[model samples]
Target: MNSHYDVVIIGGGMVGASLAMALKNTALKVAVIEPYPIPDARGEGYQPSYDARSTALSWGSRLVYQQLGLWEKLSEHVTPIKKIHVSDRGRFGATRLAAKDYHVEALGYVVPNEWIGMTLISALKTEPNVDFICPARVEGLKRSEQSTCITLSKQNPETGEYDLEPQSVTANLVVIADGGRSETCQKLGIEIQTESYGQHALVTNVTTSKHHGYEAFERFTENGPMAMLPLGESDGASVGCTDARCALVWTLPEDEIDAVMAMPDAEFMALLQTRFGYRLGKIEQVGTRHHYPLKLSQAAEQVRAGIVVVGNAAHALHPVAGQGYNLALRGVVALAELVSEAAGKGENIGALPVLQRYINGRYADQDKTILFSDKITRLFGDTSAGVGLLRDMGLVGLDILPGAKRLFARQAMGLGGTEAKISS
Candidate 1:
């Protein structure tokens, strides 16, 4: 194998794979260093499974996948979100958005994360200029006048530790997409600034008595905000109901989740029905439940000479608004676009100025999204009666105003804001 490459990505998850796919057929030779296995020579394809985890992909993100030629496979298992209902529980005011009002086929789609990751990886397997370095980690890095050198280590299968010494390689540019709490970012002196939201999100998929009818619900209560996103019908055995399944993300106060999570399934379903109301009718069943604290996180420095950060490695937003992944998708596309253009011009793609160009195009959009998600999180998460009334009125005003609704819809769809200016 070559000792060096034009570009090397530190992660091979969805965002990393997307960038690799976007840069394919170009002149740049690229390598992806991932700690997880990459399906190569195995001829792997995505298999539909029951009770699989899923993600919500915005309309703007769909365009990016289309550009990269992965949507056809993705669309097969996705459910379109045609209507969204945002409301404060027991309040008279609410905001409603519909795809028909926006003149689009659908507001967004909910697809399994497994399907997305598998599809992206499967597509990249056959690319001529791409190489997958699996079960590897960036143990150390040294920067020179023109590039960065990285030492690799292999993870032990049983111990799951990066204990095996491996070869070192250099790259003109190193893109980090490992995650928000990336060890690579730490080694490179990039700090993650985070504000805790004092809330934890409980997630699971549920089968209901009634079909979701392609509608998504974001309902706020004294506990916290909960979203019931529509899921597509793939197989009756997968979720027990072919036409009546929805993914649930329920936010609760920090102290209350453990007791709630410990409740039996029947008790949990009853409590969920009580809080979420009968919108989906009776909650028949729930898959495995998981929990995580909500926090607003950002990297202090997204770009520097010879290195760049992308995906959750760069920023993480509150999930209720569903902007985190979409924001990262745009970043992936913008970086790929700028990198390709710079490589074509024979410029130093890793130079501080070159990498800063990507950040410049990304800043406005990034700021707006961070603020937007924070606004939603803080406003609805408040428990004060005063703030509750104000939140209800805000929802009412949003519903009454056409321009405001359109603008908000555009932002939610991932098409509005200056972030789109970032060479996508």
Candidate 2:
């Protein structure tokens, strides 16, 4: 609604909302432009369905949210991951990581994506300087030395079309966190370098006969790696639902995904039980299944003169290691700190130098995470007996080796690489 702003974030998803939260109480005037309005879950009451999607938040991410003053509320719905079990399916090597051994309360936490979005969006209502503009999208961009001008197209309620606004908004900086597929990013001449894994991830929630015990499992098969992260339980009592619920990311080859997706619940569960084993007992009940092609996507350029891309728009890693969102959250905190400091000094927050600073600091961490996820996917994907044997041996070595597991665990927990701290 304002004609100009200090910062205009292009996407209102978790990353953008978090940046807004971090910048709260700062002097800068911020705005978040969102095409999708927050889903209103008020009418029928909240019900945690087995079909719900969950996100894994590393231990380092916990510190960031705590800094944003959201952990107290997020703690209510999240389940702490006490241990991580990494094993090569049907192989002799397996490794286990426990939080207590590392002197941390948890390795990570899993929370439903819906819960995170709702919490962040709802909390934005009280932010005096951060304004949320929903049901709107960017159509045009014109950048200059001083600022960038954005053309807005308001969504039409009656016809579900967009009506362009005659007046545009100007901002000292434009932060794009729209997602992997962003038309605005392309329009700005930023290129995304993507390496396709030629694999698809079958995502769903399942109820096991036994409690999950707050453990996460990463089982590598010949074809791909599949992960079953512990989700605490259903929000309310549901038919045939038990206390042990988990979020499953079963990666499969592209050729076999269609057939697998079409299989009956019983057949699917049987197949999953065979592949995953009964570590948590039986896969008793399953929820709706969704699938997405897996790939490694990175923006060739993350910062421009007055624009910065964060989150999935910048880089989307394979869910094999669950590093995508955690990496993006670190970027969010870094950008907020830099922007706040620039604002305090009355400097141009969107200057190329300021934006480049963010990229400079985050490049190594991004490289490590992207490589780690890709290597895991490729390493486990090899069906050759030689590679498989070596991989198994590596797992065994990881288990017994000194400091190897700790370093690996630190990377998984988003605590490695250059540290990005919020400047208060």
Candidate 3:
């Protein structure tokens, strides 16, 4: 086994990479073990290709990425969502959140996930204190009183598997960011509370006749709420003309998922257009669609002795409001702040108090986001008339009351929560 280090992060995904880059200039020796490479960073000022996947970058998250020096590299690919429109079709319910009203440049930016990953990778490359071991697979994990040991094997690209040749390393703190159902988290005997929503989210990109103009629409249909986020480029671009594009996240019942998947191209497009409405004009072309099963999972405890869980490994919320990444960003920011403060004080960076500080700081924010997302999904996803009316009324009430709207915007932007301030 290798000698003990200050920290060993298990996953090199967005949140993990953010944590590493956040501590890049610090004195702590940090190592990241990821089974896959981060992202390609070779691009001239991010002329973003039409990416199939994207995430809503909240203002709070944007600030963190900016501090990490990632935003400047990929900002051009982002489409600022200047307004968010929320409504239900059958009821007199509508609420609008405007960037100008919030006194910000824009409410948030819809950025391709690939760009975020690429930017994080670019930042990670410049850090000398950070040891990133990717294309390597973790074989085993063992925990001791003082440190946790991780066994890894080099991977073979051809076979798409790991070589048997093993190497071991130990760290004072082991952070599991391997995702929701993390093997390392399970190995540490952490219990996860999971709730299956029995729904599948269908995501795709579509070109519209009318430009979204950086406006995001969230409409509650009978099936579920559909989120339409503006995109920079269309899937099929034409010469001398720009194609207006947006990403659709349609939540469907599990029973209907197979049928939706089996639908012919035209039929599927019709269904999508009908649900999304004509506000964006007729949907001209639909990109390839994919579905993900919905679930809410939260870890019972984020810290234990020498271990800490961050990002999806700590909490997985419904993507209805697109709070998953934003919440993860919050946790990462909090963890980074705690670690930096402790290290600055010349204290043991991986000690129990430091780990506990992260957990205590993140618990309320993560819990609120999870509960709120779950509630939103349940409230709007229901087809019952009575429940639908209540949701509509809530929207209508928020619309009429300016103060309520700002408060809701604050929560949606992940700026105001009961948890400890991450940036301060």
Candidate 4:
């Protein structure tokens, strides 16, 4: 295998794979170093980005995917979210945002994480300019005047252990998209600011007695915020289920997650119904449950002379607003555009100026999104009467005022503020 390339992306998860795809048409040669190998279509083995979890893609993100020529491939697998219903439990405050009001076909779309991973990975395999180095761990990084050298150890496929001797790959640029808890970023001395939300997000798929009508729900309860996103009909039909299937993201106190996870399906559904109410009628069935502690984390520095960190490696936020991946997608788009331009200009893509340009272009959007996600998580998580009152008022205002609804909807759609150059 060639040891030198124009760019090497560390981590081949959603963001990393997206970056590779975004740069496929460019002339620059690229490599992706991933710790885990892509799983076979029939295998039950763990796939990093391809899991049972579902992600909400904002409308602007849909446009970005469309521009990349991937929307058609993914559209069939996704469930269009025609409306978003948000409310505070036991309060009169509620708001609804509809696609018709905004003149958009849908506000957003819900897609399984596996579908995205499979789509991006399959597309990446066809890119002649990209090399995929899988089941390999990046052990060390060295930046020199000419290139960044990455030290890697390949994992034995059968044993799933790194037993090979260290090998090196030198590239003009190195991009880190390894995810929120990036040991590479820490090893490189990149500072990260983190704040635990004292909450845990319990996720699962649930079937409703009534049709979801392609509506997404966000209900703020005393425990925390819960989101029910509509799932594609095919998913339920494949399992011989006729009821509507929706992905549930329920936030609860960290200490209570164990008990909740241990609860039987019927008992759990009953508890979920109590908090979320029967917006789509009774919760009839729930698939496997998963839990993860929540936190807000952001890398203090996202770029340097020869390296740039994108996606969860840069910022991981609470799921309250569903902005983490959308924000990362925007950053990826901005970086890809800048890198392509730099390559076309015969300039060093890893040079400080070029990397700084990427950072400068994306910093404002990142800042605003990080702030928005953090604020929403904190505000909705607050259980105090005063804060609760403010939350109700805010919901009421968003419901009653078209202008306010539009602004919030736009932000949620990832179309608010200055648009990324790639989107334009």
Question: Can you write out model 2's per-residue Cα lDDT over 181-210, one digit (the tens) per residue?
Answer: 878888887889988999999999898998
TM-score of each: 0.94, 0.95, 0.93, 0.96
lDDT of 4 by residue, 368-406 (tens): 888888888788878889988989999999999888888
Global lDDT scores for all candidate models? 0.85, 0.85, 0.79, 0.88
A best-first ranking of the candidates according to their lDDT comes to 4, 2, 1, 3
Which candidate tops TM-score? 4
Q: After superposition on all CA atoms, how large is the RMSD of candidate 2?
A: 2.7
Candidate 3 CA-lDDT value: 0.79
Q: Model 4: runs farther than 4 Å from truth?
A: 41-45, 235-243, 418-423
- Residues 134-230, model 3: lDDT tens digits: 6776788887776778888866868977777888899877888888778887776789989899989999888889988889999888887789998
Q: State the local distance difference test value for candidate 4.
A: 0.88
RMSD in Å for candidate 4, one decimal? 1.6
Per the 3 Å backbone cut-off, how many clashing residue pairs does candidate 2 have? 0
lDDT-best of 3 and 4: 4
How much is 105 displaced in model 1, in angstroms?
A: 1.0
In model 1, state the lDDT of residue 117: 74
Question: Candidate 3, 404: how far from true, in Å?
Answer: 1.0
Q: Which stretches of candidate 1 lie over 4 Å from their true place?
A: 39-51, 155-163, 235-240, 418-424
Q: What shift in Å separates residue 146 of candidate 1 from its native position after superposition? A: 1.0
The candidate scoring highest on lDDT is 4
